[model samples]
Target: MTKQGAGQAGVGQRWTAPQRWTLAAAVLGSGMAFIDGTVVNVALSALQRDFGADVGSAQWVINGYTLMLAALILTGGALGDLYGRRRVFGLGVLIFAAASGLCGLAPTLGTLIAARVLQGIGGALLIPGSLAMIDAVFGDALRGRAVGLWSAATSVVTVLGPVLGGVLIDLGSWRWVFLINLPLALLVLWCLRGVPETRAAGEGARRPDLPGAVLATAGLGALTYGLIQAGERGLGGSSLLIAGLGVAGLAAFVLWEARAPHPMLPLGLFRSAGFAGTNALTFLLYGALGAALFFLPLNLIGVQGYSGTAAGTALLPMSLLLAGLSGVFGSLADRTGPRPLLTVGPILAGVGLAWLGFLGVGRPYLTGVLPGVLVLGLGMAITVAPLTSAVLGSVSADYAGTASGVNNAVSRAAGLLAVALFTLLMLGSFRGSLSAQLAGTSLPLTARAQMLGQSGRLAQVPVPDGLSDAQAAEGRQAVRLAFADGFRQVCLWCGMLAALGGLVGFLSLRGAGRGRQGGGAGENLHEPRGEEIRAGQAAPGRR
Candidate 1:
């Protein structure tokens, strides 16, 4: 394999055949991963009904996938840089497609959860590799525009996942949602034949940070498990103990990275203010986006009486806005710099989320949902391309895989934590509201106690047997309102997180631009001089 970007046909080229094929492969491979992330959310209700799962159990179906992706993405990035981007990316697509088949064939909730975890492992590898390939193949002059097109195309495909999943769930089965990945994976692998293989300067000599990978995996897994446990049983000695160990493991991983001979994640990358700020913004904004959206389908189907397809169709406006506007924003960032767009995008997204938090039952979709969804979509479109360009541009092309990996890791971790933490918050709000609503009814003591016991089921809690028509109707309405109350709190917190991301970007990313490479190769943490920048490809050893 040649050194990254060394005389490649696509390198420094504009819209050439090879460049177009490379971009297509990147988009399809990454789009497969992003689609799975949202499609599962639309399938959650059916999953719970079929499997007899409570809210806690259903959450595992999501967090299980995110857990492995958040933990292992850094190593996946390093592996791509060490081995070959195309090779690793193709392998990841194969693994993901196989895992998706397993997910669809799963007869038990445990089996489905296991398959999702495997799918996450595949996602960790391919997502960063796709972006790194783009960064490496395109010249500095064309990279931002290329990134924008990639962002726009992927965003459109990503949202389409839900609509597709909903149709499958309604007309066929939730199993079809997972099975659909098979054909997409085949297309990505086919595209990979034309894509070149590229690796860092000293690929064979550099060793992966195995110890760091283990610690990171252990830390994130423990924290996710502990948080899910707390949401089910409330804070307890065992949960706290596990969560404390998670913190210790993460601290150890950081310590190891600072001293490792060939760190998978070069800590020096964070020295750039633009790099640090973009990641911080990614964490807060992506976290809010993932966690809040997790609850939307549930609210619509379980509380607002929407069928799966109708609920999925309702979110189309957001998808359209992202597809239409992302490329324009990406090109704009190349000319004007990313700081202002980064600052404004998240704050606008936050306001949209806050508006959604006020929604209740019987509200019309046109008035209640479309406005907020449009605003949120617009904000995300503005944020996505600039954010990607800023992170990639912060480091030299040799470390593109690692830089993209780190940003993705932060985004996944944010979603993982937010889902767990917000589940806890939603449970508390649901319980309190359900109690108050039940108190106003003439239900018997024993029935009320039984209803409270099933509070973990949220809107799916059944009306007690032998109740009069009036009482049963009241009970069902009470369940809907209770679930709505909890959902509102989740959205409000999500709004705060998105707004705070904007603040972080404004403060930390001063003078950040698309063309500047802030730091390169861990040894040179400071910005490179003109001569050093020119020689970045010829560096002697890995960071």
Candidate 2:
């Protein structure tokens, strides 16, 4: 069947009891992955306390999963295309469940990090395969609505992650956060049996692009490691070397993609202005989003003295706003073109971040933080759906799975880099400010030295009692001032990133052009010949 016809037919299928159950399972699995992405931040301190590790060491819990997810998401999509989507989806559920169990049982920080990496691999497989399955099964009329529903549903779960994690940690222990995934996974697996398998187009001859995969993985991995190390080691010596090599390797991967007969990422897609703009915007916008998400919780708990649940609760308003508005934005994009929304969204987000930058210590949450979070949430809602539509709409049906995979990978990579870079900036500013403050203090030289030595843990350090009340009060004020300064600097950087993204998006978008109505650019691209298909197609196997 033609791609359009297939979509229409798929949607036309009655929502039978079995089909409904299957769809529910897919949504839960996909939502769990996205939710877990942001949920663990609130528990970082708890993890550190339980495991007797420093913040830097504890970060591996997040980095391990993010790195694996960012590196392998595109490959996951390709694997889904090679294997039966249903089969891969099932395997992903199994893998995710098993990994979650391992994480819950982990006795040390190292074991937890390892399990997180494995969980991420399963997540990489599940997200794209589930989406592709929805596309292959749903009809055209329902496709947009289904995608919107799926997006909305997952977003709700993402927003809830913090609250759920907080409750689990408060009521029980941090381990419950990981354990919660088990029952959800089991339910999904049970529902999976009813989803029909879609046959792979090139089942017999398809093989992975191993060289391209290796280069891309190594490039991102090295770059992230370098950024993380920069906070403590500075950008000299080994850091610079690793960073440079990463850039070079990434450049080589791009070059290789252009010439590879069956490239891992088809370079031709960049010919579409909409596609390029959307992907670039995705990278920048998401990078900013990730940075803000990572830092905001730290600021709330470390500087503001909020509990884990309270910090997570602070995020609820923004998350709720986003969940409500994203579907509206998607429908709007369908009716009007994506250009205006794309341009406006990032600009508003930039303004929000810039506003937050001005907030100092002792500022009330309602007066300072709420407005910024609200505005940023609205902007995110406006941008995300349209961006997804643009990328998927720019490619052909056969390559839909690939395009989705690439966009997802880029988004995750943006998040990974954002976390590393922003953490470095925040920590660097905090250290510099604290050091300067300590140097000029008139208190005993020993006290000043102690403060400087413990600067990284200033939030946790008790006010020293050797001095008068005035002196102790001054010391506390100094620490808060340093943290405020660092937080403001990071927010300013986020603002700059968002504004730059806006400009790039405005310039690159094609407006309401010939292909904007939505069958996509696939029909215009040349189809593979019989012999070419036999050689280039991916084989059917578990992702």
lDDT of 1 at 148: 61
Worst-scoring 10-residue span by lDDT in model 2 = 534-543
Indicate the TM-score of model 2.
Answer: 0.86
Residues 1-543 of candidate 2 have per-residue lDDT tens digits of 777676777665666664565567768888677667767877776776677664455666787787777777666666766877788878888888899899989999999999988998887778667676776665554555566566556656766778888888788988998889999988888888777776447542255566777788788878877877776578888887887888888898899888886677888877777677778887887777667666666667767767788877876776676667766887898787777788888888788877777667767889878898777767766776676666676666656656666766777778777877777887788878876765566566777666666654534434566987777777776677777788788888888888788887778875644343335444211111110001100000000
- Model 1 C-alpha lDDT per residue in residues 376-457, reported as the tens digit of each score: 8788778777777777777777666567667767777787888778888988999999999899888877878888898888
RMSD of 1: 7.0
Give stretches of model 2 more than 4 Å off.
1-14, 52-54, 139-148, 203-206, 396-398, 439-444, 454-477, 510-514, 517-543
Indicate the residue-level lDDT of 303 in model 2.
71
Each candidate structure's TM-score, on Cα atoms with residue i matched to residue i, is: 0.86, 0.86
Q: Candidate 1: where are CA atoms >4 Å away?
A: 1-25, 131-153, 187-198, 203-205, 393-401, 511-543
Task: Give the C-alpha lDDT of model 2.
Answer: 0.70
What are the lDDT figures for the candidates, one per model?
0.77, 0.70
